[model samples]
Target: MNKKKYQIFISSTYKDLITARNKAMETILGLYQFPIGMEMFSADDSEQWEVIKQTINLSDYYIILIGHRYGSLTQEGISYTEKEYDYAKECKIPILTFIQDRNVPTTTDEREQDPSMSIKLNNFIDKVSATKMCDFWKKPEELPGKIAIALVKAFTANPQIGWTRVKGEKLQAVSSELAETISENRKLREKIEELEKLLVTQKPVLSVSLNSNDPIELTVPTLPSPSKYPQLLRRDHIPAHLTPYITDYDITSYNNSLPSKEEFEEYNKNTRYYHLKKASIDFDISIKNDGKLKAKDIFVTIELPDFVEVQDKFDSYKNVLPKNPIPKSLLEKAKEKYIKDNNIKPKTSFGVTGGLVALGSIIKPYSLEFSSTYDDIIPHLTKSQSINSWSSVKDKTITINVKNLIHTRQKTFDDFVLLPLKAGSGFINISIICEEYDEAENYTFPINVSK
Candidate 1:
């Protein structure tokens, strides 16, 4: 009985995955299959590429190991390893891919340092992951076992015209058959190129996705302290109703608890009152144009909750009265004390009435009201500042990714001043509109606000 041996083309970033490549070769040999790669090809020679393509064409199956390094690129700006994979695909060779697990950090030598190259590699992986059945490997030792299993499955599911030994008289016939197969593969490549050209004229189809799992949440700001506050002030100690309106002076006057100025300041610093600190959320969006036509002027809008408000200095403060009403006699005595302390004339027509009104206003509790507007709710964001450039491209599909789009500082709805935060939480709708499409696609989700 004669055993068949298959030729497997192994492709990857050379230097970075050298050990991985060796393990793959050993696994292939263990299974009695021939492993071929760019090891013998000269680095600078142009003819080596043609040889590489010929080798890929002759191989029965294709296997690629994608790592951090993008490897060297050709004149077309595509990496040589990727080009080989494309050629194998064009030839209809059975392909298996083992990608380095991105979640696991690798050694510096095994990773790509350049940010641009890293983006390219990631894009390439996305393309491969989308198109074929691929496995992820974190270490070189893990690759050989995984690759052996994948190859076994691939062979069982899809068998190819593998190599078998021939006698002296059959050698000439084998050579002729090899030449015929090469000619057929060349014609197939030409046909694939023609189909690709036809596909270029199709209409633009855009695909957009928000990568985040949870909704965008806002962080509450700690209140300002007047330098002297209780060392351990629990949320319960600060009366919920009186909490928002508590001022530095209230600490000393309330219940005759005379806390020093330093304690108040410390308390103020640690409290969560109407501090101008604004809260923001980040968005990670990806847009893809799968058609031949380009997607122009893509715009994305994130809508904040209606309760999230922006306040300005000129905005009127809400009048919050005390929980308990003061007696008339006590009010009159307080008014007299205020006039005497400030040395204001008590005989004017507006007299104590104006002073009483001012006194009443001062005694009333006050806190910031978080609000939002149609315009301020959706802050002006730029594509360059918010979204990232395209990371991957395969056929007509191109992927554009945005790592971070921060919406932290927002102007108050009434005050129109920049504040570190605004407090409100509920369902918010985020929309992405593009000139390429007519209607705006909206993403509505719930956000829970917490400190």
Candidate 2:
């Protein structure tokens, strides 16, 4: 069987996963996605899903990053991840998944969230890894190394470029030794190219010619999730010996690892549109003159496309499908049932709504709503003050990710005064209530917390 060249289609929420997504894509495109901020890109680059779809369609591999809210649907009760995954499944693209930790919920009194590391991460392991699907890194610092590994695996499993067999690429042939030899990032590409060139020079026959008689398969088989995995995705054959390793299993702060797939379903009435609690993203905003506001732990918003209509059920083509921007979501439960019981694709269709919605943290790399420096500095704030909350779904946007949750009892803070959230196109009003009238009428001072 002659394998087709693989182009990875990165599916993720913009605000959350942008940095990581771009970082992953960097191995191939090299800053190609620089301007495509936290939301959907315009006609210039990723204007349509066509580019993503076409890449996945023509290629043999796929990468799905699982952030929090993996299975969230729009008002129409559709999950965007499900839609994209559905398409990937249709194309039979070989998928490798990376999942990150959702916020491990904590109570008000605690300084730390008890570091619920493995339990939260378990959802990821259950849904994503197998012989076919594998993990990306778990920590932010680890993403690049993990992505590099994924790219190597990708280049190996389907070693062909344009028409030639790209040498040094074979599944399972990429040992840690070869990975170690990759050495520094500066020389990485050059070294690989040199190695490939040398191999071609030494063994002229190392390269093979493509033929028309090759059997074109959709996706190669993926390794199955562990039996004890939280959510059992499509169960494929995994070696029995591998089972021993899967038990008690082992999750420590090890090397880089991606989380597993996550999901949600419907218990609502109409099923067309489901109601949701707004995600309140709590963040601390320290304002100074625009040189660089050290907004610690700033969060990104992952809103449904405004154009996406929330209905009781999935929208049929005519009633739902948009000519361009397909931004609709579908109920994962319904799709899973359809696949299990009826074997069909989602009937609902939508175009991407407003700007771009993002998930995953700065680790995934998307729009920079705050200073990129904030990303590198967040871990040092041991005070554990900033927070994010998800409120009700409003106008396609999950309003008030409320990234900063710190309250100040002091009337006068340092130059780092938190200002009123600016009113803009997205807001109804910016309510700045001065709790007590100042004798000097000083607007610069921090007002008392409004009752």
Highest-scoring model, TM-score:
1
Write model 1 residue lDDT over 217-312, tens digit each, in one string: 556666543332324333345534334444445444543543566655544543433343333233344455555565556554444455443332
- C-alpha lDDT values of all predictions: 0.62, 0.37
**TM-score for candidate 1, residues paired by index:** 0.38
lDDT of 2 at 352: 23
- After the best TM-score superposition of candidate 2, give how far the Cα of residue 226 lies from its true spot, in angstroms: 87
Error of 2 at 206 (Å): 65
lDDT of 2 by residue, 1-451 (tens): 2243345567665555666777766754532211112135432343455665665566545667665544334334334554566677787666667766545442343112334533433543564555465664555456667766666666676553433344464633656557766666648788899987775444211111111213211111222222222223221322332333332222221111323333112212112221110111122222111111112222222233222222211111112111111112222222243344543333333322122122111132222333455555455433322333333334433222233323221111111111121121221111111112122111221111110
Per-residue lDDT, model 2, residue 433, is 14
With candidate 1 superimposed using the best TM-score fit, by how many Å does residue 230's alpha carbon deviate from the native?
Answer: 99
lDDT of 2: 0.37
